[model samples]
Target: MYGAFWRILPGPWWIRLLIVLVIVAIVLYSLVTWVFPWVQELTNATDVTVGG
Candidate 1:
């Protein structure tokens, strides 16, 4: 399983931390791009403005 894989792979903490960060960033990006629009639709916006 994944737990075993994590235990078997030997590396520094920063390398593991970097991998976790990259995975998290990828998942977050996927959620924001593909799933966030539905979330936005569910909420009501009272005020909004774009200066640019």
Candidate 2:
């Protein structure tokens, strides 16, 4: 699957690497900004205490 993705990207090696890095950055940003916070709210994990 990864091989197919690399093959599908159109560019030299450096350009392809930059594209992959940008995609990764966007995914991480969305997770941190929205997805993780939503999941935290749903789970209400902050109030839990360990061995208290």
Per-residue lDDT of 1-52 in model 1, one digit per residue for the tens?
9777566655886777777788889999999997888887887675567565
Would you estimate the TM-scores of all the predictions?
0.53, 0.87
Q: Per-residue alpha-carbon lDDT of model 2 for 1-52, expressed as tens digits?
A: 9999999998899999999999999999999999999998899766768777
Clashes of each: 0, 0
**Top of the candidates by TM-score:** 2
Misplaced by over 4 Å in model 2 are 49-51
Q: Note each model's CA RMSD in angstroms.
A: 6.9, 1.5
